[model samples]
Target: MASAVFVLAPLPLGSVDLAWVCIWTAVLSASLLTARVDHGCKADLWFMVPILAAIAAIAVIVWIQVAPNILANLQDPAWGNARDLAGIDVPGRISLTRSSPLLSFGYYLVFVLGLSRAYLLGIDGWQAHKLLKLVAYASVCYALYGILSQLLLPDTLLWRQKEFYLEYATGTFVNRNTAATFWGSGGLILLIMMVRSILHKSDDADSARVRFLDRPATQAVGCGICLVAVGMTGSRAGILITVLSMVCAIVLYLAPLNRGGWLLWTSVRNSLVAGIIVLALVGSLAMGRISQIGLVDGQRYEVYKTVLDMIRGHTVLGFGAGNFDAAFPPFRPASLGSQGIWDRVHSTPLELVLDLGLPAATAVFAVAVFFFASLITAALRRKRDRHIPVIAAGAFFLGSLHSFVDFSLQIPGFGLLFACVLGCGLAQSISTSTRGLARRAPDWDSPILR
Candidate 1:
């Protein structure tokens, strides 16, 4: 879990990319070792089988169609490497070694499943609690960094080239919004943990590690700190999504489904109270930003509108994946010529449509639907803490909602984090498998058992 947190935690420079490679290498090596140590363990086999099959199928399909162009991109100059395939220019062809169909599918496949594994281990395995702690610690560190960064060096310093992005607070992230997104998601999860701990006071020893959550004042304080961080980032989309996620969590956990019970009314009343509290805090801390967010008649709103136009133009296949960086200009207003150098679509669904076409988009949506349904069903069945799934569900919804305006999830780090949380929720929805540490252990920590 420490290793996982280190791998995913935000870094100040391009070092995060290096961390990604290192973490993946460690994960793969550990998996191999664990299989040898726990010979009878079928955890990896069961979890990986479907993921491998999907990768295999996608690889075959992409190879036949996209191999040549991808290979060409590899050899081409960095600036000119990007091309319009199926209307989208695959992103990062020049910077990355492989761009062919097979590699692309393989990359995304691993990316998705790696997270699924994390989620599975975190939610169902004994490591779930540990993983949550790791996440919280990492988040608190990140929040502290943001606050300090603002205080010590409010302006970008000469040594800090990366600190120029003032629109959002990056903390340890490459982008401010990305940092806030992480913090926001972590905030929601923390809220759930704190609330759950409160509801289970007698299980004090077991919940001691997460005991800080039991205090209402502490929860409120934590929420306040996180909300302020969210506001400082100037991420209206993120702020909205975070609030929505909180609401959804409440609805999923507190709302009653039974025929006759005060649960429904209680849930409603609680929701109203939570909503008021969140609103009051956010309104106080972020009143200025909130006003600006509501009045979105400037460049940002125009960018969103233009993206809508582009999506309409290429509705069926959309621009090819990564093509928006090159394809955005033709759709932009002439006055913003130099301003719109074409970097991103600023929208995830639109990006998807442009990347693989309508069919691919549909396929992605289908997968999301399946995961969501399964999560909701599982959460509802948990006669105990319904809020757990509610929190997960809210984060999922919020992240998806956020993708509409910002491409935060497109960043590999952010994307991986999103996948990890979603996968964890999905895994939780399924069988609640519990394993003795001896029987089920990741490879890296296997030696510790001895």
Candidate 2:
């Protein structure tokens, strides 16, 4: 039930609040139902203490008012009397500069708790597999909906007036790129499942024929639909990144079959044939839109420069969490030449620096890199459940790359999904033993066994 909500929550404007409620409910329900709660990591408290402390520090910075003298020192000299002239209602108290600091904290807390829950759930392989299946099928449903909507109701989005990207497949999302990334992650899972089916062949030919319309074929069809939807979104980066992820999955799937040269060749040949068919279908639907990859938006570069300037001024402490829009107007570059509101900088890393300062942002980045490295190591060394780490790695790679050029990671749906995958990867890394260790295991009578 929670998995269903998580998968479908992205449809309603990315479901910022809805996702939080669903996750909170799921966590509480799981806690009540289970007798033994598996935290999944022995070092969980050691790792979590600092993270929680950081969150506490941020909360203090956001909710409490700094001394006037200290606040004055932090302000730019150019703002001169603005800080003094902006009269305060209370003598020693002033809210954060952010437009909605409490809201920002709420979102951050939700993500933290959600990741924790996902990690615990991922410790059970069966549960993780079920979650993966849910994600894939949900994506397929959304993909089909997006495709049909584009074909049948070009001017409407989810049966409402289309605000933007009229011709693109937005898939219940306001932005086509978000839809593409979400479905792209889903497509990767389906691709992995398809590859697994190919690698693990059934012995009984009669039974295999009887179950021809089984899970594998269904996954293949879902993957095709997702690819077509991604291509139709007209997002150049989305198509390229998704294709790269697919290629990575294919290489990983084929690399292990190299012991048998003929078998490896056969697998490659079959994969190529399937790839060609899927690509042809995607191409027909996209109508050569992938060629637009070369086009670059200069406005984004200007925005990035402005964000850098903001970061430099607040090198130690940021303006405030969720304060980008409020803090941006003063730093808006003249070169931008736009009167429209600049809400997001289109770069999550730069935005993070602006929100949490360099130190905090660095801490976050380091943790992420550590988990990614651990997952990569586990994927290469572990004999069983290797696909789990591979899928997680692929998801992380897609989100990380997309974040550089776009704000897909900032969207709650994509952010939550990425966190879930990361948690699963972390769980897999801790639970699986290295091949060498497994080989060295002794028999029941051995001293080591005791």
Candidate 3:
């Protein structure tokens, strides 16, 4: 249900915002009505503290950006210039607009709510498996729709005209890069399922090998279709990052070779060979597109340089949250060309620094590092469900790497999807033993317990 609302709404701006309303409502309702607080799982949720703190810090900065200079040191020289021209005192602070950051808080809520909702449901191993499978199926459905639409419609999204990216398969998104990340995430999930079956980690390892081979390879073909959709997007970095992330996931799956005997060795060899074949064939799908654009986007590279300079000037307290569109005009270098309206920095970190300042961006980065470390810890600790945490970590890496060059994760739906996946996996990965339990629960009624 959560996946469909995000994946199907390709034309966004208003549509994306609406999707958030529905998602937040459903997640919140489910959380309030049915979500339980298991002592063990609640303890594990402490990992989200840094993330919440980062959000709060940005919120405070946004408030300060809008506060009166006399009160919060947010005076803008632009207001002075306006006052002199108008012959009347004009008051203004940092942010160009009041609503942008306040509206941006919605995106932040998506991250928090997505993870919270998923973590709540993921406490049960059964539900976690179901969640993973649901995402995988939805991805395949979207991938097939994109491939068919590119072939059949060619110029329309639903009933409306595409107007741009006519030749590229964008799935349900407006941008091909975002589509690539979306499908690539799906492709990665499919690959994880394949690896799990191949590893023969099922309780009945003896029969797992035969059952895996005997089963129809629908997911293999599904992965191919997903790759085809990704390739059709013609996003060079998207293709490269997706394939690299898949390789990393494969390596993580193969890490426990010591426990394997002759049977597992054969499975590993077959899995590796298949991985090589898939990489070469699917990678070739994007080769033509890569050749056309080469490695660097010249125009985009200049924009990145300008954004970097802007960040340097506003290192302490940035212009304002979601104020990049207003903050960028003065700093726009001539080399970037004055042809387009520049709002997004195309890089998440640069934009965050531009909006909330460097310290806040660092806090966000630290939160990510902490989560990655937790995932690694889980992978190392768990014997049975190791793939869950490892795949979650790999998924985060995929989105993070892509965010460096493109803003896929900035898209509310895509970011929320990853958050939910991470939340679900982390819920399962954490020890969840009696560690999160209170030591004094047994003595609650006794005076000594107090």
Candidate 4:
């Protein structure tokens, strides 16, 4: 039930829906605790502790700045010019963020706790697979809605006012890039399922024969639909990253197959050909939008430079979390032409540095790198239940790569989904008891593993 709500909570594009989802998630987490489920904390708690501590430190920094005496005592001369440029008085109680820092902290807490609960759920193999299937199905449904809405009602968003990007498939998301990210994730999941189906070998004589209409074919159709929806989003980064993720999935699938070198090469060639064909079809419909990737968008580049300046001013402690918009106006470059509000720097990494400063951001990044590395190592080494890790790795790659150029990670829906995948991957990597449980339980390996 919690999984379903998590999958659908992004549709409304409001905070209330996410808050309700968080409440239900907390309830579900409490129930799991009562059941005494292994939360996979033994493997990741060390890393998580530092991240939590960093958040706490940032909170402290925000709180202290609110007190005039503390702010004056800690004032730096280097910040004087930036303060004058921003037109804000020194030692004032106002936080750097446009919104309340306490609210941002609450949201971050919910996200972290939600991720921990997902890890617990994923320690159980059956539960993990069920959650993956549910998320995949929900993503596909959203993709269909996006495609249909764009074709039938291009002028409206969920039957409401269409303020912008009417021609693109934004789905239930406010941004086309975010919608593409969601669809791309769904495509990766379907791709993994399709590969697993193809590689499946059944011992039963009746199941040994391959049929024209099979699970793999069905998954392939779904994957194609998702890819098409991603292309329709008309986002260059989205299409490229999604394609790269698919290629990664194909490579992961081909790696462990016990096939001859010639056969493997042929399979790779065929997969590449299929990918090209899909791209060509979608590209035609996109009408040269993919070609725009070669051009540089000066506005985002300018914003990136201004954000770097902001980071330079606050080398130790950042302005504040969720403070990008409020902290940006003073550093806004005249070259940006003063036409639009640069709320986000459009790069998650830079924004993290801006919000948390270098030290805290570095700590957070190190933890992420360690987590992903652990999962990838497990995926490569594990003899059984390898698909879960592979899928998680692919999903992580999609989100991480997109973060370098877009703010997909800042969006609650994408962030929650990414965290869920990360938790599941970590759980699969480190949960010894779950493996033991699987062995003691009934041998319910699907036909794919038989």
Candidate 5:
């Protein structure tokens, strides 16, 4: 799954009518068929939640809006892209969700299920490690590409487009920032996996014959490559989030929650060492040209201002999804004249609420809180294995923090990666005896000993 994400991320699907979606449609059909045959298999049910919810939500919203005018429009409904569906349109035929809806309802369904499959099938760790390896390898490859790009075909890359001068080392991606976001997520994931392995002394082995995550030294080297690649991407948001995640992990290490003794001390020590390694690798490019970092900082601040103005203008329902640029042109303060169209608000939650309405935004937020809360609880439960909660909390926290500055979730590739992590965390929790769902409680204070 990780390799698939990494490989496909750099490529553009262009229109919503792309053929790749059909593969998922096939998967969904097969899952249903399998369920019918297997009756009560948990594996089949795992991937259905997000897809089912998205379908249900879209269906309800469409029905509610068109029920009044269904009879009138039944002959020839007003068909159009999803953006039209969300706007203040009259009741009519429900938009075909398969079309480019706000969240690409069909895509999200697949994302949720894929993650769920990783968790239930117990391949989460293996897949994560595999993903890390791909990042490491890709980073190494990108490093070589960066050198070549600087020396040779400096002006020819298509993704570079007109932003050639401003472009940082984007590797295979069209935009430097997008490349950075990709490698940044990869670096952080690699670090988390390595740290977990070293601290817990657990083997990352599984039935799958992947020799990738089992060896410690190889994993560390891969992480080094990824760290370098991420830095080269020159993404402020990615760097910020990576640093924040490390800081959180360090604080967790210092706490005596695990053993409160020498083992705790060792963990903290290891955590510090790991943090230093990450910093050294990521900060290498900035060592000589620290001033450039400052320039990037200013650009980020300007972007933030733009995002704020956008929010202020559309507080009730922010710019519609995929309509950031369309909405921004009018709302943008004249002070930043002709700032150009922006595909993203660079902030996920704000963008989500702005585009999908407050109710939809609230639902997304609830899902995040639920997952994070569960992860934190799992981490503190002492008896539970330390690595699972630690990875989940660290990854989720890091990604969430990063989202404040950039819309990682909006990117199909990163969004899918995140869903996988979330699914793994949820699966781990379920696997543990402490089921999160409400069950009949044992009669409290009804002890026979009393």
Candidate 6:
């Protein structure tokens, strides 16, 4: 339910309060239920500790900045400017905007709750698989609607008038890039399931080719729809990043097929070749659109340059959490002649550095890298239930790369969903303990075996 709420919300902004309430409610309810049934709410989701700790550290920093006169040195010049303009002493704090940091903290908590709930649920393979299936189906619904709505009501989204990107399919999101990421995410999961179906159905890869072509092609249809929607989004980086991640996931997931006790890299190569062939057919539109736009947006590149310049000055303490709107204006150069308010800097890590300082942002970034490595390692090591880890690993690639050029993962809905998926995969990847180490071995001396 938490995972459902994390992704199903129509708009990340308008629905955030409700999403927070719903997801946290689901988490608490699940915990209580587990305590009642299992006598405890124990979960081996230790892998999430690094990221969770990073969030907590950032939250603490925000709290400090929000605390009046606690660290007089950390207060921003904006607070002093307010006092000078009013000719009175105002509260000294680091954050230029109080509500923004508080709101950021709220979103962080919601994400953590979503991840925690998913980790617990994913411990049970049956339940975890069911949850993933539900998510995949829901994603297809999103893609289907996104594509249909583009055709029937290009200038509309849900009950509202869509003022921008009318030519593209954005589904519930306002930004085409975010929508692309969402669609691409769903597409990756479908691709995984489809590939898994092929691997699980037959032992001989060569023999399975004909059988695969003959089997029902339902998953392929879903993948195609998702690809089409992503293509229609017209986000070049989004399309390329997603497709590359899918191919990598395919290659890695099928890397070491142990047939007759002989490990073969042939299947890995074959998977890559097959992926290219299938994508050429299924993702033609998305692939075609990749060459439609130049690799970089000039305006966005300038923004990145300016943001990097800003980060150098305030590398220690940031402008404050969620106060990018407040911090960006003074730093905005006249050369970039855009009259629009530049709140988010298009790049999540750069924006994060501006909001949470270098250390905090680096901590967050490092955690992602850690997950990428851990999930891949686990995917290779684990025999059964490796698909879940594979999906999570691919998602790390998709989310991290998109984050460099877009802010999709920062959206409360997408962020929470990503967190949930990562948590679930990490939970499944770790080996479950079969027995307590403290428990004495079954009385071998007691002659039951004899």
Model 1 alpha-carbon miss at residue 95, Å: 16
Off by over 4 Å in 1: 5-7, 12-65, 69-110, 123-125, 156-159, 201-221, 256-262, 283-287, 293-319, 335-337, 384-388, 431-450
- Among all windows of 10 consecutive residues in model 5, the one with the lowest summed lDDT is 441-450
Q: Please give the lDDT score at residue 210 for candidate 2.
A: 33
lDDT of candidate 3 over 43-82, digit per residue (tens): 6547656656766787788777776564434455666677
Residue 183 lDDT, candidate 1, scale 0-100: 74
- Candidate 2 lowest-lDDT run of ten: 441-450
Clashing pairs in 3: 10-172
lDDT of 6: 0.71
How many residue pairs clash per model?
8, 0, 1, 0, 3, 0
Candidate 6, residues 1-450: lDDT per residue as tens digits? 455564565354324464455555566456535531231123353454665687679778888768787677767878888899988777888787767887777666666766767776766554555567666666778889989999999999888899888878888888888878777887787788777765554333364344332233766777778888887887777777878888888766766454432344666566668667755654555556655655677778988998899878777768788888878888888878967667688999898898888988888777777777888987777655677888888877898899999888777656765766787687767744431112111111111111
- N/CA/C clash count, model 2: 0
* Model 1 Cα lDDT, one tens digit per residue, 1-450: 424633453453322354464555456446534422232235444444555554554454444333334444232243243454344465433222234333334336545555645654654433544555456555666676677776676664224655456544666666666766777877787776665544444423443454454455576566567766776776666666677677677666644453346767777677768766775666343456667556343665677777777666545444444456656665787655474345766777766766555666776666666667766875666543344455567777877777777777766555555656665565455443333334232211111111
Give Cα distance to truth, residue 173, candidate 3, Å: 0.3
Per-residue lDDT tens digits for candidate 2, residues 1-450, read: 446445756777676564554565465356435523443445544344544665676667656423233565564343344546775333331323523665676666656655665666666554665567677778888899889999999788775799888878888888888888888988988888776665554344454453432367888988888998998897766776787777666655455545577877776676667656655656443435534433466788889988988788787667667778877887788888866668887888888788767887887788778767877776665555566777887788888888888888877766667766766666666543321223111111111111
Q: Report lDDT per candidate.
A: 0.56, 0.67, 0.70, 0.70, 0.51, 0.71
Off by over 4 Å in 2: 17-36, 39-72, 75-83, 86-99, 201-214, 256-293, 432-450
- What is model 2's C-alpha RMSD? 6.0
Q: Report the lDDT tens digits of candidate 4 across residue range 1-450.
A: 457545865677522344654664566456446543544445556545654675577677556534453454334343465567887665444346434555556556656665666676777765776677677767888889889999989888885887778878888888888888888998898788777777666454567555543378778888888888898898877887787777776776566563478877776787778767766776553436635545346788888888888788776657666678877886788898859867788999998887666887887788788778877786666655677778888899999999988898777767777777777777777644534554322212234222
Off by over 4 Å in 6: 10-45, 201-216, 258-293, 433-450
Model 3 TM-score? 0.85
Between prediction 1 and prediction 2, the one with superior lDDT is 2
Better of 1 and 5 by lDDT: 1
Q: What are the per-model C-alpha RMSD values against the true structure? A: 7.6, 6.0, 7.1, 4.3, 8.6, 6.8
